[model samples]
Target: MYISAFPTFSFSKLIKRKKAQVFSDYFGYENTRFFYRGAYAIFYGVKALGLKPKDTVLVPAYHCGIEINAILKAGINVKFYDVTHELEVDIESIKSNIDEHTKAVFVIHYYGFPQEMVSLNKLCQTHGLKVIEDCAHGLFSFYKSKSLGAWGDISVFSFQKSLPTADGGAIVFNDRKEDCFITQKKPALLTTLRAYLLLYSEHIHMFKGFLFSVFNTLILKPSRFILKILKRGGSKVITANTNEFDAQYVSLGPSGITEKLIDSIDAHGIVVNRRRNYQHLLEGTKHIKNIKLLFNNLPVGVCPLFFPIRVNQRDLMQQYLSDHGIETFIFGKKLHNLLPKEQCPVAWAYSDELLCLPIHQDMNPGNIEYILKVLEDENCPLN
Candidate 1:
């Protein structure tokens, strides 16, 4: 069976869940609000910020297009900024782009590594611009002593990426003074069922391989139709890791089951295991000639979302990994056409060369070692 990028469903967690009364206590954050997906959180958060129509928000060029969609849907104008080839935000580029009309700076913590928040916060403070931390890859991630979600004016999280939940996204207000609320009805039953089935097939070992694929392909279309009839999360079947945004469902909230599923996650175990796997690969791949590690050192307090690498040939390397029963992701290759044609060369290069490796909590040392060997193989010409 092929390994997945994020941890899959574990029935063990569902077997032991907290009651509704303690749901608030589980996350331990008083100002956190849940949504159907990260894009919804972005949409609502931008709205709540009280920006006027066509007010510009600065965004990274190497971004998931769905985020750009959410901002556009919120009636906000977007200005792209360059991020270094190493995936670090270009502070100078950002400073140069800020204008009187720019109301906010959207900072994405690419692959759970927190951006230089102190510097960013200081820069934003001088210009009176609100900072929105896109922590979609950064649940339980910390920058120095402070947490990623707590550093920005508004922060967004995706439990669907970090946990076993079928669907969940959250917006957290860093400043307790800012009060915002969102209420959404539970998704349709068919939508929830389809999500669970997909999770089971992907995450559960017993259900892996061709049979699961056959089942999903056969039932997905019909399930989507039933979902549309039932008015679920959306009319379409929105799978995880989708490249495009589904604007129709931007207003929807999370399923009722997500609340319970999220509580059962072991945050510490996830961090420890993922870090171990990442460090393992980082150390082993240092000598390879054809690729470059995005972040060479795992910093203290940082929880990585994936092992991002820049390969000489992304498509060929991805196929090489897939043939060995390993899966890889081309994170954010689909740039929005709306971005200016001439700007952001570094981000454009990254979109083509960058490949995301699976280093989820589910992977063991053997699994990580196998992945390393594949990349470091002398016989394989990944370049």
Candidate 2:
């Protein structure tokens, strides 16, 4: 039984008709605009913030390259800020980078752990730089008593990453002056059709059997491939969130199905189950001498996105886990051209070493134990 990093969808979630629900309270935003992907949310956030062309913004060296693309699409210039091996922002690096043209500072709360927002916010305020929090991983996370997304001038969230939704993204504006709702055209029907197929594939993947794995590898992969060749721009649906940036898809909003799926979610249960799964991984890996857990303690109110670990043989370990029916992720190993690998050694090293294991709400205790046993395999070459 492979444990996926993201949640598997249920047919019940798709067919049931529910009343339209507002998620402002859950996401800590009074208003939000949904998009087809997280990159679009960021794209519009820059526009809403009035960041003009050639206006520089400080961004973390540790990032998904798509964000850099979104900023560039908005015609904004980007400067790099270093992040520590422990995934914390280097405040001094950020301070040194801020200059006359810098209009905003982009902050990413990697793996749903909140950064030192108070310190970072103070520094941004000192230079009068607007803070754009990238809470793509921090949807249900908190820093002290405040939610991760609430602290920024504007925040970007990805429902696809954290929720069981097929495709969705959102932007929350803290400053009402920049708060304007957008009415983006609905995603294409072909896109919506692919979303359903992918969702069902995820549901089928939740079943524990070699037959299921074969079905996923054979049926789902081929179906998606054929969809790519037959439909218009279907390849983007498969590769939407990878390192590559697609300008053509930037203006699109989420499908109606995505909105309905989000409305059906149990927000509190997501946080609880994710936190529990995180602790299971934490406990399982705590005693291992060969690797280091990037984050050891789960703070109160923080919903962990994954269990990040550092090892010399990251690529090998990821393949090993995949072979054993567990999915692992490597976070943002590709550095954008704006921030070369040579300039940010720490972040580059982290990009190479960090492997994110699944801790989503979908996995049961049995699933957790199986993943742990694989991690502790003595025969494994990667120590």
Candidate 3:
């Protein structure tokens, strides 16, 4: 049972298409545009809000460097604010960093968990700073009965995180004071094909159904050997966040099929299953000895991307889980060089401590049981 860290793709969902809806569709932001990646969407959204390189934007100290890079590539000066070990945006830190040059603040809903948005919004409003909601891990997430993306001046989503797509992302303008960006042309054929192939391989490899098992034995195995023979087998794709933001590909939209893939998505079912799977992990791991669940109380309407836990020895635990075929990883272990570790000790501490387990919609109770069983086993890092 080789579980995946992220959701795997499948053709069956696309074939049973009904409504052409996405998580953002319910937000009804009128002004939404798709992009090749969430990082590109961030770049476009920040620029669209009339923020220039000379202006400063407050971002959390703990984050994937890609968003920081996006703001930097747009020439915006970023002021790193402290995020408490709770992963909530530190409001006082935001106040300390704000100045005349501060035009906006990027609020990341980390791991599909909402921040203190009502207060954060009020604070941003008082300062006249635009709130840029980074929903990279929060596609369908809601905070206090309202959508997480809806609380911001503008919001960006990474569809690939929540949906099974090759390459897709979006930027929704909630209160645009400046002109929004026009949709760019599609990416190169090779780029799109390579992205799909990477997803396809994961789908087949992770597929457990008898139908896919036969196909895997007959088709996938041979395809891997042939690709190896041709030296064409690789999972690398020119998607967002893998490298620095490229201006050349900045305007490019998602692949032609990405929209269709999203259209066919089981939006409601995915939400239900993910929440269910997450609850299973929460309840099953209650008796665990060493690990701490970051957000132990799963709030209603929050769409969790994973079950995150803080362990004393994250590397040891992660390796043990990987060795047992339970895919897991630490989040935000690599901070941007510009972020001072000395200034944000808590963020640095979390960087070394947090581990995220797979809790995607496809995972079942059995998978969750296996994960917990491995955690309690003698070879476990805690033991």
User: lDDT score of model 3?
Assistant: 0.82
> How high is each candidate's TM-score?
0.88, 0.91, 0.91
lDDT of each: 0.79, 0.81, 0.82
Query: Considering lDDT, where higher is better, how would the candidates rank from best to worst?
Result: 3, 2, 1
Return model 1's CA RMSD, one decimal.
3.6
Candidate 2 colliding pairs: none
Task: Report per-prediction Cα RMSD to one decimal.
Answer: 3.6, 2.8, 3.0
Clashes of each: 0, 0, 1
Model 3 compared with the native: what TM-score?
0.91
Error of 3 at 194 (Å): 2.3
- Model 1, stretches more than 4 Å misplaced? 16-27, 177-182, 205-241
* lDDT (10s digit) by residue, model 3, range 145-244: 8887888999998887778886778888888533644658887765666567667766765665445667767776776666566445553336543746
